[model samples]
Structure formats: structure tokens, C-alpha cells
Target: MAEIRLAIVGLGKIAHDQHLPAVAATPGISVAAVASRNATLDGVPCFLTIEALLASGVEVDAVALCTPPMGRHRLAAAALRAGKHVLLEKPPGASVAEIAPLEALARDRGLTLFATWHSRFAPAVEPARALLAEAEIRSVRVNWKEDVRHWHPGQEWIWQPGGLGVFDPGINALSIVTRILPRPLFVTEAVLEFPGNRATPIAASLRLGDAAGLEVAVEFDWRQTGPQSWDIHVDTADGALVLSGGGRHLSRDGAILHDAPEREYTEIYHRFVALIGAGASEVDLAPLVHVADAFMLGERRVVAEFHW
Candidate 1:
């Protein structure tokens, strides 16, 4: 098969750090151009907007969107309408209602639309999944706490109304949780703690359950001071299972079970190439759906201000 000429939209930190490098390293892929409002690539073609890029007649097979979740639907819709496959960054869209339209557009155009979740491609995650499949899960707990200033820095959009705030990282946990568990889960109750000055929450606690009465509680806080934790612990009939280091390591019975270097973006690129080659679309919004449900049904409380 011929190489897929790809263009990247929204050249932000994720594009520079993850997508760019991964595209460069992957086979059967070439980044022909980049679209960003405030940045430009040295050698590759750059455009200020997606419409401008399409209007310029830059022939490319696919476009990867790395924009914030707020206004991504229109860009994605346009890309699909223009007959270009789209690879959306995680949290696909701002709301649950937005995803169906994009999916419909992609189907109407017969183009591949991939909503990438790089975290699910983590090495240890599948291994952990295999171990947990047979065990009778008794309970599950997730502690995903980090210092937002250290992680997100001065990114102001994260606190905006549709930006997802702490869930910007929390969804990664949800993705893994949804994958590893044996059955589907739904949010029962949730509490969102928002900064007095922001529209998004700074912290969230959710209670999730399955039909079998399994209990899973998730806690996300963007105010942790030191030693950030991205840990998920599940207790089952076969001792206890621990997936730590953002699903890069696994431990059980106080012993390390599995560990490997992270190649999440590499795997994501491989999958993208394969999906494009086979004319397949991969867009799973269950994680984001749960987030939206939490937001709609959660009780909100005002908290202290957050300043970087």
C-alpha cells in the first residue's frame, strides 16, 4: 500500500511532543503539513485554519486534530466532509451529543475517523487486563491526583466550560478502567469541586457500579503537591491487583508483576496506519460519555481559587 500523507491540526504541546514524534517514527505515514493559529512547522506546510488548509488544495489522505475539546467538532466535521480521514485527540468532543453527528459525517463520507486514546495503548495495560479477567472483582479504587500547575502549566482552556478541567487527566483512568473490567459500568453518584472563579471542576469523586453490584470509586484532584499518583487498585478473590505509574507497571501481592517502557504514542500511530489501510474507523466515546453523565448528574460545590 502507498504511504498515507497526513496533516496535523492544532499544533499544540501534544502535537509537538507526541504526535509529531510518533508520526516521524511510524512507517506508512508522513506528515505533509500542519495547521495552527499561533505556531508553524519549519519545513512542513502550515495553515492558520482547517478551512484554509483544505482551501489551499494540500492533497492529503488524513488529518490529525490535536485541538482542545471545546471546538473540535466543526473542524472534524469539515475534514470528513472534505473526504479526509480524521484522527481526533482524546475526549473526542465537548459533549455526548456532539459525537454522533461526527460519526454520521464520517459514515456519510466513507472515511476513517479515529478518536485516539494513547493511554489505552500503554504496555502493561493489556497484561493487567488479562490477569483481572478471571478474578472475581470485589472492589476497585482509583486515585489520580496531580498538581495542575506542574502538569498543565498556563493552559487556560482547561478551566473553560467545556474543557473538562481535572477530567483532562481523569479520562485516561476511565479509559483503562473501562477496558480492564469484565463488565460495563455506569456512574451512580458524583461530586464535582470547582474553583470559585472557574467553570470546570478542580476535583471530582465518582461512584461507579456494574450490574453484579461491583463498586468502583474514582477520585480526581488537581491539587496534589508532591509525588503525583496515577494508581488503580482492584481487590478480587485472587489476592489484590495493582496497576500503577499510569498503567505502565503492574504489581500483585507486594511483588512487581509486569513493567515496560511506555510506547503509547508509537502503538497509537501503528493503529492509525492500520485503520486507514483497512478503511476502518475507531471512535469509542464511552469514557467521555461517563464524564458527561457525571457532569450532568453530579452535585457541584464552589472551592478556593486556583492560580498558577
Candidate 2:
């Protein structure tokens, strides 16, 4: 019941911008140490690797793995085996196969392993899910476009094999869609636009459907300029439901329903703490599974070169 002594594993942009601030604001939690090869947080012990952090005996109750998906599995397994709860960032692992063993390990050890989908904590997501629960669904359209240069900046690992390309942000949309809709959705057809110079796609268009013949069209692009957009439009027998601003704002029939401040990371920490207190783990792989299915079944097209 005392303050959870947490250590952050990656000191990247997301950790500095979101995780640090969220941890500071949340009660009953304190950042005890950090482990990153190239970055460090002020006033905390920094280690070059998770192995070093564990061997140093820093006495951390939990660790948040903010590293890229490529290295998440190993770091998380290490933390869990060391008798510490683990919090994984979005997409969890590079592939679906990498997550099962870690989940099993955590379950067997009686430790909490939280695969956090931060977007699910958005203000409008729950409301949208609640409303759609009673409405007869017709169709869904997701348009998630943004300029990657502005958002990613110098993040080169994004174009690598496990980087997830545009899906890095696109997965956020998928997470919300999977949560809000009443039925389970799976990819039927997909087209990926990969740059000649990169291993990942710059854009993707997917057609997803469930058993009830409900089809949803999704578009993800990293080439948008000027005005950025993250909107999901759902059409049902009742009317139109729009979730714009990345699930921060919701509207029905063009009338505002819910719009509030964003506190995704804060809520994520809260959930992590609760899970630790309850001695349980929350791991959802639907969004990541949809992504893996897309890769297995989707057709790939080579596009013009993309430069940072």
C-alpha cells in the first residue's frame, strides 16, 4: 500500500514527455530509477541496461518499458523474473508470438504485466463505446493521417523491420475501434504503400469486417501536411457518431457530446497501480493481432522514396 517505486526502462521522447509527467502527478507512485543507454532523468539513478539496474539492487517495485517493440520482450521478461511488475507500451511486442510467453511468465509468477493501450484511456472512447452498444451499426470509416516528419522527427528506428511504420500511430485508432465496436473485427483485405527507401509502409488502406457482415474501411497515412487529422466516423441506423481529435472529442449528428482534457498516460499509470494492488494482469492483443494479420494477408506496393 505504500508508494510504488517505479523505474523507467527507456528515456525516449514518450517517457520524457508523457510518462514522467504522468508519474509525477499520480499519487502513491514515485520514479525510483531509470535505465537507458543514451538518456537519463534528473535526480534518479541511471543504469546502462536493465540487467545493470536489477543487479544494482535499486529496490523498484515496478518498471515501465518505453523502448521500441523490438527490445520490449527481453527487457520485460528480465524485469518480471526479477520480481517486479512490468508495464509495456503500445503494440507490446514486434510480433504476437513474443507476447504469450511473457504473459505466461507473469501469470505464473503472480506479477502484474500491463500491456497498456493508452488511447483507450481517451475521454470519448468509453462514451462512444456505450452509445454504440445500443445502436444498430451500419458502417465505420477511420481516417488517421498526419505528417510523420513533424511527429517523429529524428526517430529512424521507425522505418526498420519492427518499427510498424504508419501503424505506429494507426494502432491507436485500431485500439479504439476494437474497443468501441460491439463485435470483433478482422482484416479481410489490405493494401500497403511502402517507400522504395524504407522497409515499412508510408500509408495503408484496410478493409475489415466481422461475422455480421459489418464492413469498416480504414486509412492511415504519414504524408499529410498542414492540418493534421485523427477522426473516426461511424454510421448506424440511429445517426452519425464522430470521434475526432484522436478520441478526445465525440459528437453525434454534428452536436458535441463529450470533450475534455487528455489524461491517457495518467490513467494508464493508475490502472497499472491498481493491477499491482489486485495481483492481476491486463493484456489485450486484438489490436496487435489485426496488425499481424494485415502483414500476412495484405498486398504490398512500392512507392516513391521517403526521406527524413
Instruction: Please give, for residues 13-120, the per-residue lDDT of candidate 1 as tens digits.
Output: 988889988998999999998889999999888999999999998888899999998899999999999999999899888888898898888888888989988789
As for candidate 1, its clashing pairs are: none
State residue 121's C-alpha deviation in candidate 2, in Å: 0.5
Clashes of 1: 0
Per-residue C-alpha lDDT of model 2 across residues 177-278, encoded as one tens digit per residue: 999999999999999999999998999999999999999999999999999999999998989999999999999999999999999999999989899999
Lowest-scoring 10 consecutive residues by lDDT in candidate 1? 102-111
Q: Which stretches of candidate 2 lie over 4 Å from their true place?
A: none
Residue 219's C-alpha lDDT in candidate 1?
99
Instruction: Rate residue 171 of model 1 by lDDT.
Output: 97
Query: Model 1: residues >4 Å from true position, as ranges?
Result: none
- Residue 249 displacement in candidate 2 (angstroms): 0.5
Relative to the unseen true structure, what is the C-alpha lDDT of residue 294 in candidate 2, on a scale of 0 to 100? 89
- Total backbone collisions for each predicted model: 0, 0
